[model samples]
Target: MTKKQEYTGDYPEKTLYLPGPTEVREDVIEAMAEPMFGHRMDRMTDLYTTIVEDTKDFLDTDQEVIVLTASGTEFWEATTLNLVEDRMLVPTSGAFSERQANVAERLGKTVDRIEYDWGQAVKPDDIRDALEASDEGYDAVGMVMNETSTGVRNPVEEIGDLLGDYPDTYFVVDAISCLGGDYVDIEDHNIDCIFTSTQKAFAMPPGLAVCTVSDDAYEREVEKGDSSWYGGFRRTLDYYDRKGQTHSTPAIPIMLAYRKQMKHMLEEGHDARDERHREMAEYTRDWAREHFDLYPEGGYESQTVTCVENTRGIDVAETVETVSEEYDFVFSSGYGDIGEESFRIGHMGEHTVESVRELTDAIEDVAGL
Candidate 1:
């Protein structure tokens, strides 16, 4: 047979295996394709406002929602700039979780941390003990809701519960990879600040970030002025309050994409989408154990994605390349430091059991073990 002809936007693309930019549903893809409008007009603000409202419900927060044009990293900075003062306590288990310490130091806040083994969830007991043991008494306890680098989902609610005794210490969570993929009840966790990116479970292309800030966190930022200027929470909150818009010109197209994607997630029903993720993860994990072992332990694996340890040691990168050529699906080989001996398989967005089996079959064939 001759090589198949290809044309952009003419044919539907194959599935994605990467952690983000996963397969988007047809309805969502078409939602962004709807008519464009002036960003300065009432239409844009209305769209933006809708997203903020939708995000609040999705995150289960009664907090103020902020949408930015940059990646989730920016929102991470916004949290420190917005409310964090003096010192913060972080429990780092993976690359991204450790990164919060770096950002906090750069933002001129003192940091304390209770370290956990890589690819392991930080236990609620340890967090509670740390909080009890610390004489300095941190103002905030920060953690990643899910650690993508090592395929671990931290117990955010459990950790947040540890902070209840210290009412002044707010709980900050990085829900970058877990926001829409699972349920996050802000009131239950007493989360003062939570941040996330658009590309993961939201099933949209990268470039926009979202966060919900509690009134306590907002007031804290007001008490500590000038932590940051541009893209800072204080100014953005003021802008939103004044005219119900971003402080600067927004990323109109990405916001448009978000509006469409959020609608799709809502239509899919929260319980159903979450159940799909759980079921897909279960299938993928069981299959992976038959051939290759998972990087993280049972009960701690990320539901939206899985990291396969390079136990086969059979040129994981080359196997990915071959599978991509024949199967038209691709995912990265783990994240930093762990990339050499591991690979990730994402099941977020529209990825299903059939898609996972397709990729798994390709892997078993290519690896020949």
Candidate 2:
């Protein structure tokens, strides 16, 4: 006789208020349930073209768009692999930004960095100083538009304006946490390459990494033969131009979800979406200040996530666990060393100010503050 195993097929439903992999829309999830199709078929081309064109229109940029079945980290390596010829200048302000510099070094590229204290935004003047001081000059400058760890939004536009003088040096931005929600003018800022993950602000399930590549970046890669054969900007863009589909197999199910979600995003329009994120940030910041304090510098807090300082000396992990157990809601503690001293509340994606209030109210109830 076989022994019966105990099983409880039930899982606790949590409304994610964490940084990445935030709450996914029900319809978006269902979209992935769509029937499978052949990747080489015309139908795949239609799906690929629709999402690519829609993303370009949504971002209001004429640059090439590449959607790969990978995380935003893939672009970090791809950009380093393809564009950087000699040395790359990276600004280190937080965990993710520092990791970008580290990735470049691991790829055997010379990495020059302008370091800042964690929670502080990268100073554009400091970047200009680094560029001015570098006698040999750098091939590219990498930065994070939003530092997810400490919840600081760097002045990418100001840094981009500074880069305009150094035309030979390309500018790359990691907009993983901010793209769809923050409303950056990529073309106007002269940003050569910027990438994001769908799980962050696109309000979709994870798997796809979307990137915008400028003509300058493409041309530079073309000059360097055999650069990043797999994820190269020119190769991907060329394949899309020829067949209107990805060079490699893509996550078709996720693309179906992306098609559906991007339609909703385009309908909402960039102005409205950006305004919504701004409102959520303002509301979250106001709430944090009321209960505790913001971890990031003044006037530079992230529009997507708010890292609240433990001014009242509350147990952050315990408070988070209690709130989750009581209310079936979840947010994040700070990243790395600051995890115990600070907590994070994500306000991006499809989250509304009303939804954020629900989590805040639950936290207050649990913390008794």
Candidate 3:
């Protein structure tokens, strides 16, 4: 029999530079330690409503927001079940976007993909071509705003604008890694549904997913009559309208943390946060260009995470380990097929350009850049 190892809760505190589970603020962490309350209690309602409304304000959107105790992946399934009745269009660029399409397929929906190279962006023209080429109408068109695996930022706004032409086809975007940091005009862009995770640009701990649902998308789910019980827009939003809490029991501690972090987010302001992230991305890309090269195509790079091509052919895994062990700075190697060929640096979530340079400096020291 195999023996299980016990956790001692003693470990080196390394700064996170990975795509997700990014470094959360100390106060946010402390907020999670608040006393627990019953889900039905007024305190729970206060916590839930605060975060939901704050999120709407943070995004500058009038669309209904849903906060659930799940990863951003939950919306991949939820959007599929709610919006896509029989067919959806997904433009595959990187791992995350591909997975979303796969989720729809697994739900027994026919998924048509306009494939792009991992580092290439999803073009709106291609989406238009796909829609025009198809004789049958699609129920939804889904795409990832930022492909974390390859650092490609698809032009979701352009696609959303084009989707406006196809009124019958709803537009759903998985903005899990860039939503809070990137300034997306959700309503102006005609996006039907957009979702994200707290751990990414929100700079909070994992276990909460946030999404904005347009009235059209919500009504479509209602008409479908067969939707995810836990993730249904009708179930969650209607319950919030009546009880001011999640339909299911939520992670109250995380809600506490969310409330705290959201206050910080509001103070920072969405446009300011977007500019900060943009500066970090510019700095990271400059550094990458100097020492290595960027993995993603030019002009479509992600602002939250930067994937550096291993141009100098340094040992990515070894350098990551050495930086963590020696400098207590943790970054990420490339994801999936690009593993070892590239490395990723997460710059979102409370991290400034000065702090990001600290990791790059450590990398240069360890990798002999």
Candidate 4:
């Protein structure tokens, strides 16, 4: 029989510089310790409504918001199930975007892809060509706003605008790693559904997924008539309209943290947050270019995470381990196929340029750059 490890309440505290599960504020952490409340209670109403409305205000959109106790990946499935009745189009540039296409196919929907290299951006022209080439009308089009794997930020807004030509096709975007920090104009882009989790740029602990749904997407699900039970827009939104809470039991503690953290987001303001992220991206890219090369194509790099190509050919995993062990700083190695060729630094959440420099400085010391 295998022996169980002993329980220890203590763990080392390391500053996170990874794409997701970024550093959450201490106050936000404490907010999770609030007294428990029943999902049907009035307190639950206050908690749910405040977070939902605050998210809309933060995103500056009138579209309905759904907050569920799941990762941002939930929406990949939800969006596919809710909107795509048969055929959908996906433009794959990196790992996450490919997974979005895979989700649709796994759900038994026909998915057509306009494939691009991992580090490349999804071109609007390519998406336009794909849509025009399709003989059967697509029920939806999906793509990632930020490809976390390669630090590539695709022009989802431009793609969303292109999707405007096909009003019958719902446009779904996975903005998981950049939504709160990147500040997309959801309504203006004509996006049918866009989603993110609190773990990324929201600067909160992981547990919740949030998304905004256009009326068209919701009605389309109604027309399809076989929507998901837990993630259905009609079920959750209608429940909120009638009772001001989630249809199923929710993670109340995380919602408390969300309420607290959302206030911080609002005070930062969407535009200000966007500017902060831009500044971090600029700084990180400059640093990467100085010491290494960038992975993504120029002019389309992500604002939240920067993937630095290992131009100097240093041992990435070794440096990451040394940084964690010696400096107590945690960044990420490149994801998937590019793991050894690149490294990534997440500069979103509450991280400033000055804070990001600390990690770079540590890297320079350990990697002897």
- Please provide, for model 1 over 90-131, each residue's C-alpha lDDT reduced to its tens digit, 9 standing for 90 to 100: 888889999987898888899888888788888888878887
Pairs that collide, model 2:
none
* TM-score, cand. 1: 0.92
Please provide, for model 2 over 125-230, each residue's C-alpha lDDT reduced to its tens digit, 9 standing for 90 to 100. Answer: 8999999999999999999999999999999999999999999999999999988889999999999999999999888888999999999999999987757777
Q: Which ten residues in a row have the lowest lDDT in candidate 1?
A: 5-14
lDDT of 3 by residue, 1-369 (tens): 989999999998989999988999999999989767799999888889999999999999999999999999999999899888899999999899889999999999999999998899999899999999999989999999999999998898889998889999999999999999899999988999999998999999899999899999999999889998889999999999999999888988888999999999999999999999999999999999999999999999999999999999998899999999999998999998889999999999999999999999999999887
lDDT of each model, Cα atoms only?
0.81, 0.93, 0.93, 0.94
Give the 10-residue window scoring lowest on summed lDDT in candidate 2. Answer: 222-231
Query: What is the Å distance of residue 155 in model 1 from its true position?
Result: 0.7
Report how far off residue 344 is in candidate 1 (Å): 0.7
Off by over 4 Å in 4: 1-7
RMSD of 4: 1.2
Superior candidate under TM-score, 2 versus 3: 3
Q: Which ten residues in a row have the lowest lDDT in candidate 3?
A: 34-43
Q: For every model in order, what is the number of clashing pairs?
A: 0, 0, 0, 0
lDDT of 4 by residue, 292-357 (tens): 999999999999999999999999999999999999999999998899899999999999999999
